[model samples]
Target chain A: MTASLIRILPDLARYAAKALTEKKLRSLLTIVGIAIGPMALTAILGVVQGYSNYVINQLEGLGQNLIILVPSANYDMSSSDIAFLRDLPGVKEVTPFYSLRAKAKQGVRDIDIAIYAVDLDVFFHALGKLRLEEGSLPPPGDTASAVIGHYIAFDETGTRYYRVGDVLTLTYYSFKRGRLIQHSISVIVAGVLAEFGNAFFVNPDVTVFLPLDAGPKLLGMKKWSGIIVVADSPAYVENLTKFLREVYGERANVISLIEISKVVASITAAMRFITIAAGSAAFAVAATGIAATMITSVMERTREIGVLKAIGFTDAEIVTSIILEAILMSLLGSAFGIAAGVAAAYALSTRGMVLQGMQVVIRAPPEITLPMIVKTIALTIVIGVLGSLLPAHRAARIPPAEALRYE
Target chain B: MTRDYRAVDGAESTLGQSPGQVPILELRDVHKVYKVGEVKVHALRGLSVRIMPGDFVAVMGPSGSGKSTFLNIAGLLDVPTRGKVFLLGRDVSRLNEVARARIRNRVIGFVFQQFNLIPRLTIYENIEMPLIPRGLPRRERKKLVLKALREAEGDTSWLPKKPLQLSGGQQQRVAIARAIVGRPRLILADEPTGALDRATAARIAALFIRLNREEKLTIVVVTHDPELAHCARKILMIRDGRIVGAEAPQPQRCIAYSRR
Candidate 1:
């Protein structure tokens, strides 16, 4: 066994080396077709993984035990909605949010912004860690006080737009008037929210705050977009979810942090299948290239096969040597291909793209970890072995005398 | 060395009723036929011959006259349809394909008209080819190959070269080295000098005679050149599938006549 193994090893090495190094262009072309699948797959997966991580981080940053609630358009809510939700058992705090697409004008530049109408008193109560990097919060009963996102602040003026007392203008559409209502209310740009660097585009500072009762009157708001509820403890997260479900049934799109994360996971699973299909196609093409090369190699080495057989190489050894050559070529190609892919992915990921509305460099998640690399290698190995099967069998079946006679 | 020699002798003794006078290879009424669709072709017909140890015999015949076919059967490259072939004492006709291959690798070596030296292999690797099937250790196989090269080419220093690098004469010598590397009982050369120039052919013929006399290696060569055929102590001439004539068994007479 040892003798047979030793005899065939050098031939395998020679064949593989000749394939990879001597015939470099052909080898590269073969590798290109193979590399496409994994490259696209790993990159897309990296982005998806990064995006999911960003969303979870954003949610987790909001606070641990928070459940978001949305009102169904079919089911109108009474003015006692806040009190009804607060009165529920284990309820800690409830903050209603009203958001609409509104235009913001500073001097001459008008930018379309998402206007978030929040109850400043209970809003900060739920989001205590909300940082005001430039300006301060407006006082109570002040309808004219507002804070805009950092992007608006920067775009309006060169930089440093929000100070302690800079008033900002917001244009709203009043349904009663049935026309565009430009509200030139002298509101201080209370604070400028710092940029949370990511691909996502939600800016809370481009927000106008009002007293709870005055919210609908000033913003002409009818239905709330969603409500943010904080749980007293982490343990009440599930109970709060159930409680909200009981109250809303299917009417409200009541969701907790965990539920949102699960939705992202489903999206991730779907992405996985798409990338796998794409990668599998690329791998098949690469495998076909490998098979063609192996068959051609077998034809070229007919006389060598005969000689090896005449020397004492069994049929099994001859086949194994050829297969070994193919496998070695594939593995080496995969290593180079994957390395090139990873480098490309890293470079592309650092560029601007929407990941959870933050302007941040979203690096691929750790899930594209060691197992993924190992799996790529294993895939290449399978491709190699399967690709060489026909050629190896052909080589093994050659008659020793006939092969020896081959010119 | 003596053990291997005795093994060959012991095997030869079991061949037929003749206890000690066993030829290295004995073809007893061998017949080979081929069929293509319904058309049958007889390649050999009741051919019988005995090649004794240390005998340099040449089989001469025209193309398609069964000389190559006879050589193929004698070399164990192909089996006869009928009758028995005895390598030493073993009836190869009864042996399975694998067993026959084993005997061929161990007991017989072949040189071909084409030189059939594996092109990709170096001279040394080419010579070592026959021993690979014997499951010999790489170290021992290397030693035998080096020994064969030394004996055949006398450390010519071109022994490491490939067949393409060597002259026709040199390549034939390498083929001879490969054939005798395993020190088989019988060496069969099928028109071994057919592709060479006159001088190169003469050199190969002389090499065969030297190997036969010095190492006592029985050599069978097939050729159409009468001069080359005349160099052998025993010459068998085939016209159809059967041996029609053979030179008399008188080595001394030929030497005496040549000297006079």
Candidate 2:
């Protein structure tokens, strides 16, 4: 039986092709019904997964082995605390910094930007992905120097707003002697960093960098608010984070970039589950359409089946022919569905995600992995097989004598 | 010789029962009961008949006289309620449906009143239908299809066209080609010309006579046309589910008439 089935597979396919082509409109409609499920699943998953991957890659770029230590309420970190962190085992470098939510003005155009007063050279090494677009990082102990972010040098529309030699005015409010006084300062733009997209801790596209000593003189920052610690490699990041948590206790929050990326991956997985569940609903409807169409085909071809049986076709052969038709339809449907899905994914990716104070880089084209396509095709085949079960069974059980008499 | 070969029910008439040779087909007291929605219909009473290996026999009866039922049983398309059916000395009555289907395909061929060609398939594919169930190789099936078409007096040019695209006589020829392509020893045709005009029916009848003589096949046809019945080597009159009478016709005329 197995050998004969292999022999008749081509004939069965030919027979099924004729049936599909005979009812062109119904066949096309049924194929479209099947296509909808895969299209929704592939398109949605591509966009979400593409964006999540972009975010994770950017976070890793920010430095996979870097751990950030932030002081909790009513807590402060002095120079001795920074020295203590640098002395810890497996610690590569420790750079304590102060950040002010400042507004920068260039020709009366004011924009919100983070002013980070950290050692520019050490900061660039610890935050690995930032590169200088215009000039070099600030010289050591150069409190009068500043490096503007990409958006500060070029405005939101990408027009040139500030050059490397430009002096920028920064304004921040501080409470002194029970009065809120807005303090203003000027610093020379030593360099302009290139466009770095969203990072979990900071968006480099909308920040200003300065030398470490500038924090104490310009911002009157007596205590370090944040410490960026670099581990020797990503392998040591978790250990360092655990060790730092025990040392800082409730007075500080320790975070590793790798952990943030892991959280992002899990969230993406949950999103995939919801999308597939929704896609399966569409497949259920498509399966119903396929079942109805195949049932009608069997009913319409009653006399033809009778003739086939009279000429010695077996019940199993009849069933195989019907199932073959369904599989053929699904193959045709998936080819088109995958194409449409990838196209939709690319189109949906162009709208960048914007937040209150951070600007994400304009979206890149969506990614479609090989496994995604394999998963889509696998799902379609399942529905095809499931849809044809009852009809094939009915076709097999039909008695030749009665079928021959059908009009 | 006619009286010697005539088989009567329950008479122990040794028709086609030569020494060390069995009949091509034999039925012993076969009964068929049908149910039409709560009504028990006795379509066939206890009927028995036998045919030799190379006989052209015709069973003639009016509508609802059990000729169709006999054809179904003889063709292995349906089972009997009582008694045994033997084909080539094998008891096929007790076989499973799959086994019965295999015998129906390899040992017997059928031609119905309607051509019964699948309209979606080309004529060549229709002719190849019988051999497909046997999983015959493509080259062999093609050779057999062409040869059977020639034997059935069908033109090879019609091979690429659908059954509905041909004339009624041509369609019946294709049907005949399909039935014979498997090289079955027994051929059962039910009202082979019931849908054709008189001229076409004569042509189809002539083709059957030619096939019978040329192929040495055992042919059984159930028909209402006496002209067809007159051409058979042996004629059985069936009524009320039994063989009422049997006789021999002048078979020389069918041969001579086919030559025209």
Candidate 3:
């Protein structure tokens, strides 16, 4: 049997190829149906994954073993909550901070920047991102004395806009009793922080550090913006985040790299579900297209099938010839689909940045890995075989007597 | 396989009878019953016939007289409902579908009344179709196809044209070429001139006579045409699913006949 198949391979292929080309429109439509599914799947998934990795990498650069929690609506990180968080088993040091975006008036140029109101004593010890470049951190109770970031005195020339003991007037906006209000306060610059690179959550190169009590006394603030918990090591970060989440529930957002990764994982899983669902829908349509076209082909060639059988063509040969057409179309679709999908992903990535109001969001380009392409092609081939199998069987099972009698 | 081919080749040394040779095909007490809803349609009833090598025979019958059923069983397209079928002295009535199809492809060729040449194929490719089932190489199939075309007295120019491009006489010649291309031991033809003009029918008869006498090919043609049947060495008359008469015309009486 194998020997006969070896000899008859060319004839089988020839017949199959002729059958496909005979009805060019139907074959082309079926191929296009197959191409649509893999294209959508690859492009959507590649973009999602690329952006996911970008966010995760950015979070990793903030710091390690660090958990930041911010208060939400109707919830504030009060003294009692800070005390409770500090007393937890993996306790290291907790830094409750008030972060405000403000502008300091220097001559005619009003420099817009961030102000971090934190404890001066242990704040430097808890997180090691800062070291005073001039003078020193003020004593713990000095509310108006402040340490400044390099960019706050942002000057490209040899001129310095801020130095120690310089009284700087800063204006900031806040909600006071359900109304937006602007407050101006004068602060004495006690020290200057060294210049540093970009940071995700907190940037030391572009901020002013003031005493903790300064928020309520000078700016009419009722609560701290958030608290940063510094764990002893990276291993304790997960447990600490989990414990804080259970304690705070929906009142606070506990954030760290590990927690961010968990969020990313869930997002990726949701992305995978969406891709499969949409891809499967398209694949199902392609399958039906193939079956319909193949059935029509089989019906049209019933008399030819009769002639083949009468002339001694075996059932296996007949079935093989029909299915060969489907396989060829599937392969052609795969090649074109993958090329189009990858091209679309790159095109989308080129315009990744979107500006909504005053905020700018950037997205990363998609990655089209080899494994993804291989898996897609394999799946398409299987679908092609299964879709056409019924018609092939129907063609082969035709009785020569009845077939010869048919018109 | 080569040795076996040589032995079969030696048997064709001379066209006359060689004693102790097996009949190319034989049927004994065959019956065929087809189901039509609740009714049993018996297509053939206790039919028996045999064709030796180099013999040309014809079966003449009215419509629905089981002539087609006889040819179907003898050609291995079907099996007998009862009794035995023998191919080259080997009992084959109980063979599996695969085995029966192999016999149809390798041992016997079929010529249909409608001249069933595949419409999409050129005449050359149509002639090569039966050789494919034998798994013969292209070079070998080409040689046999060219030889069969000449044996059928077909125009060499028809090789590149599709069957539909040819006339009825020309298409029938192509069909005959396809049947004999595989060099089968038996050629089973059903209504060889059923759709042809009288002149074309006479030409087809003359071709069959030449293949049977000159090439030593065994043949059984099922037809009701007198001109076709009278050229055969023996004619079996069938009616109501059984053979009722047998006639053998003298060689001198048939205008298309040249063999003794």
Candidate 4:
């Protein structure tokens, strides 16, 4: 056995090299299909992962282990409901919110804006995700107070129309209360938000802040859209959700950052399945490429097989040689494919984009796991074996006389 | 005579010495047939022939005359459909494929018409191929390969050159070296000079005759050329899968000459 191995090794190596060199372009093209899927998949998954991560981070940053309770299918808030929720057990904070489509009027200049009202004391503690870039929080008992995002404060002309202590008028319509509902309010824009994107602090891409207690009188609402609940600790998060669900009896929509993140993960997993389902076609094509090459190689070497048999090589040896050749080809090709995929991933990760006014960061690292590497190798081996079957069998079936007869 | 060229019938002369008369190959009514679907083609028809020690024999026939099949059977590369073939007086027909292969590798060397040298291998590696299954140490195999290359008497530099780089005559020499490298008792040449020019053919023929004379080796040459067959001491003519006629170059040389 050792003697046979010693004799066959050098001969097989020479055979493999000669086969590869004989058809350089065809070999290169064959490997291209193999590299595409992993490369595209890595880059796409990286970006999706990065974006999802950023959103989750922002949500968790609002408050740790916190829950937000809202109406089952509503999008508004009222002061009366806020007062009622404020007295509920396990509710650490309650704040009413009123947001309306309004236009800021500043001495013959107008900009679209969202007029948001809140209570000064409760807003300061319960404004979970309202971050300010360049302004202070509303003071205690400050009825005419407001703050804005960074982008809403500046215009393309570098003009600041609304700022702190600025009294600007806001417009609205009226809704009759049953027989006589009405709505009309022109409130002051006490503070302009900081810059966020391409809008001024008082622009429609902007938001105006007002006193929470004053929202019920202005918007004429009897119920609240949502209520914020801060747990005593992370341990109480599940209990709070259960308590809220039991009380609201399906009328309340409770969403937590953890839940949202889980949703994102499931969605990404589904997307991955779709991507792989689509990419499998490409892989199949690559496998076929390998099969075709192996078949051609077998046809070309029919005489060689005869010679080996004539020289005392068994049927097993002929089959093994062909299979070994296929495996070597796949291994070489897959290696180059993986390297190309990684290089492509890295190149696409940078150059972040904007989505929904949030920065979309792409994270394309090699980020390859051990299982993925193993899977790639295993897949290549399978393909190699499958590819060599026709060739190996053909070589094995050649009658010694007929094969030797081939020139 | 430099060496005794008598035949060895070891069964009669059991002196524990070769007696210089070893019947290296013996066939008793060997029959080989090939079946293609329902048609059975008889390639060898109850052929019985013996190759004695130190005898240079030639098998000449037309195409499809089954001479190649006879050679294959004699070399143990292929088995007969019926009949017993003995190598060194051991019945090889009963042996398995692997056992027969071992015998083929060790007891017999083959020289093909096309010079079947692997194009990628150098002359030295080509010669070394037959020695690989010998289970010999590397140093020993190397020594044998070099010695065979030296015996070929071609350019030693060609040892490192591939077959294509060498001429027809040189390639034939390499093939000869490869065949004789393992020092097999019997050498089978299947149209060894069919591809070479007349002059190169004569040289190869001279080499074979010299090997048989000097080493007392048994040789069987199969060819279609009548002139080539003339050089052998015994010429067997085959037609339609049977030995039609046989001639001994010197019948006057009696059985005494064959004995000693």
Candidate 5:
């Protein structure tokens, strides 16, 4: 039985090809309709995967053993709080940084930038090495010196606004003596960091770094905004985080990079579900189109089916031939869809999009895995087979005598 | 010759019987009734016929006289509403659809007025259709197709051409070739020459005569043309689903008819 079935495969294939080619316009339209669903699905999945990878990489770049502590409402981190964190078990280094949102002006251009004042040695140790494009780090005890991000030193068109040895003025806001006050100061740019395109949540590209002691005096504030804590090893991060949470209780929000990674993973999974659901809806529409096309084909080929049955073809053979035709169309459409989808994905990953006049670059390229290819092909086959079944059965049920008489 | 080819029910002797002097087809008390919406139409009432091997029979009737219905029953394409149909010594009136299809594929071949060639396939592939269901290998199928094409006097060059590319006569010839490719013992043609010009119709009639005489093939044709019916050895006139007359034309008339 197997051998007999194998013997008929080539003939079945030939018949399927002939049938599809006979109505070129109709077949092409059906294929394109089916392809749209998979194409859209693949493109969306590629973009989402690329973005997820980028976020994961950013999280990894901030050391896995690193944790951050932010003060809750109506609370602030003082020197004593910093000292308590420093003496905690498994703590390698604790760097408390003061962050203030400030508006800075260089020449005639003005932009909003985050100013972070940290102990240079501990900050560099907690985060990895910072890539500098020009000049050296600020000298020790140089309260007037500041290191600016790559975007801060240059305008959007790459024109230099402030370089090494240039002075920039920053305006800081504070509440002093129960009254709103504004202070302005000029600081020399000691160095410019290389461009890091949109990886970290708080992008260092658009921020200025100042000496640790200068923050309280310059901002006229005695409390720290946040503190960065590094565990001795990655294995100690969970324990250290728990200890910090217990000690601070409701006063502070202690978050580890690992916890952020878990949250990011869940967000990506939710996005994937939405994308698949959208793809399924499109697939359903495409399947209906396929069924409609097949029904029309069966109707048009009624006489031909009669001829086949009159000659020697059994009802099963007739059904098999029709189903094979649909399978062939689906396979062709899926091949085209996969190719177009992958191309779209590659283009999206390589060339970033501009949203509201800001350029967003994807740091990771989209990957097409074997499992993805298998899944797409499997989906195509299922749609093809299911869509053609009813029409095939209809063709099989056509009476040879009546079909022969059909005009 | 009078012979009883009917096998006892549930007997193994029903299968693989040698092709002896048994009649090729026999319909005993056949009836066909069609239900059209709320009305019942009696297409055939108590029709009975016997066709011996090597016999060329033509059935003639007006439209709606059930000539086509009778041919369909004989060809195993449809079953009688009530009766016994015996093909090659086996009673097959109550066979299931798949069993009937198997019998049709193995023992019978049919030709239609429209030629019924699959438009998409080339002449060679159209002829190869019957052999495919039998699981014949490609080389063997090609051999049989070539043989049938030569027997039908079809043009070998037309093998690569599609059905629509051929003339009406050539397409009919190809259809004949397809029917004979499986080497069935019986051929049932319904209005085989109805769509052809006079000359083409005469040519097809001569081809049928030649196949019946040279190969000893049993042929049953239904047609309205008396000239075509004259080519057959016996003519059966049907009206209102009943066989009203059966006659044999003079042998001299058959020869003279072919000469024309």
Candidate 6:
């Protein structure tokens, strides 16, 4: 049976191709309509998947066993709270850092930046290793020394603002005795960190780092903004996070990377559902279009079908030929859609976009996997076959005697 | 005078045998009815006929006289509402569509008045249609198509041209080539020359006679043109779906014209 089918398939395919080419405009229009559905699906899914991968990679860089503890309200972590966290079981190390929004000026130009006062040893241990492109980390106990992120040293457009050993003027504001007071100081750039791409939640490449003692002198604040804790191992992250949450109660928000990943996964799944729903709607419209086209074809070729039947073609052969025509159209349209979709995805990823009314820039490049390709192809085939079924059967059931008489 | 022009070769004896031989096609008490909306129309009533292999017969009738209906039934394109049809000694009236299709493909060919060659196909592809259902190999199909084209006196150069590109007469010839390509034992043509002028019609009739004589193919044609009917060895006159008369023209005259 397989051998016979192989022998006859070429002829049927050729006949179908010839028929479609005869009505080139109609076939082309139908194919283009069908292609839109898969195209939208592939493009959207590719970008979404790429964005998820980017986030996961960033979390991995932050270390899987890391837990973050942030004050939920205006409350801040004190020295005793830090000591308590350091003493907790399963906690390998804890780094408390002070963060404040500030403005820095160099050579008459000013830029707003986040200032982080961190202990060099604890910061490096809790946040993973940091690579420097030039110079070296601020020397221990050097309160006047600071390390700048890649973005602060050279802006997005590659304009240099400050280099190693350059003095950057910083301005800090505080409310003291019911009045806002601003403090100004100068700090030397000890090093420039290498560029780190966008991360899961925070971008370390955009912040300035200073010696831990600078926070109290510069900002007139004695409170730590947040603490980063490293667990003994990945398996201990849950236990450490639970312990910190219980100790801090409502005062702090404790989270682990694994928990964050779960939340991200759920959000991604929702987005996937919406994207697939929209794509399936497009597919449904395309399927209807194909069915309409096939029905018209059947009606138009009634006399030809009669001739085929009269010339000894069985009903099965007639149906197979019609279905084959639809399948070929779908397969070709899907190929075109996949190429267009991938191209669109690549273009969108490379050309990052700025969020409207916000300072955020997003760059998501879609990844096309083998499974995605297989899924899209399978969907096209199913829609194509389903669309052609009724029309093919209708054509096959046409009585030869009556069809021959059709005008 | 009844004169047997069966071929001297024994191949002709296999067809056109003595009376006791099994007829290639036989219809007994056949009837057909069509229900159009609320009204019922009787297309054929108690029609019976027997056709021997190698016989060249024409059925003549006026419009709406059921000549096409009879031919459709005889060709196995339609089944009778009542009565049995025997093809090659098998009662095929009760056969399913697939079984009927198989027999039709293997044993019978049909040429229509409209020259129903698929318009999108080339002349060669149109002629090759019959062999497709048979699953014949490409090389073998090509040989058979070429031979049928030659038999129908169609130019090999026309193979690449679509059916609509051809003249009416050329289209009819291609249709004839398609019908004969499978080497079926029977050929049933319905108003085969109805769309052509007298000269082209005569040429088509002569081709049919040649196919019948040379290939020993049994032929049954339905037509309104008496000139085309005269080419046949026997003329069956149909009226109101009944075979009212059967006549044999002078055998020598048909032979002489076929020779021309």
**Top candidate, metric lDDT:** 2
Q: What share of the true interface contacts does each candidate keep?
A: 0.12, 0.53, 0.58, 0.12, 0.66, 0.69
Q: Compose the digit string of candidate 5's lDDT tens values, residues A1-407.
A: 44656678778878888999999999999999888777877777877777777777777776788888999877878878778888888988888888888888856767888888888777766668467799877865887888898889987789889889998889878887899888898889998988866655456778888888877776666888889888898888888888889988998999898778778888888988998899888788878888899999999999898878877778888888888898898888888888899899988877764433233454467766768777887798788888999899999999987888888
- Per-residue error for A137 in candidate 4, Å, reads 5.7
Among incorrect, acceptable, medium and high, the docking class of model 1 is: incorrect
| B1-260: candidate 1 lDDT, tens digit per residue | 01223322322222123456767788888898978689988988988887767778777788778887787778776678998888886688776555656667678777878777766567876787777556577799888988887767635576677689988878888888888888888888878888998777777776777787898888888888776776787667676787766663344433223332
Minimal lDDT window, size 10, model 5 chain A: A353-362
Model 4 lDDT tens row, A102-144: 5655456665557666554555454344445544666535655
Residue B194 accuracy (lDDT) in model 4: 92
Model 6 C-alpha lDDT per residue in residues A183-233, reported as the tens digit of each score: 787889898988876654345676778878777775556778788887888
Among residues 3 or more apart in sequence or in different chains, the pairs in candidate 3 whose N, CA or C atoms overlap within 3 Å are none
Error of 3 at B44 (Å): 0.9
Which stretches of candidate 2 lie above 4 Å from their native place? Answer: A72-74, A77-89, A102-112, A154-163, A171-184, A220-224, A239-253, A352-357, B1-6, B10-21, B249-260
Q: What are the clash counts of all predictions, listed in order?
A: 22, 0, 0, 29, 0, 0
Candidate 3 lDDT, tens digit per residue, B142-233? 99999999989998999999899999999999999999888888999999899998778888988898888889889899998877887887
Better of 5 and 6 by lDDT: 6
| Model 3 interface RMSD, one decimal | 1.3
Would you estimate the TM-scores of all the predictions?
A: 0.77, 0.90, 0.79, 0.74, 0.86, 0.93
After superposing candidate 3, which stretches have Cα over 4 Å from the reference? Answer: A2-10, A61-64, A72-97, A101-172, A175-179, A182-223, A230-234, A247-251, A343-362, B1-19, B155-157, B250-260
Task: Give the winner by DockQ.
Answer: 6
Better of 2 and 6 by DockQ: 6
- Residue B24 displacement (Å), model 2: 2.3
RMSD list, candidates in order: 6.3, 3.4, 7.4, 7.2, 4.9, 3.7
- Clashing residue pairs found in predicted model 2: none
In Å, residue A171's CA in model 2 sits off its true spot by 5.0
For TM-score, the strongest prediction is 6
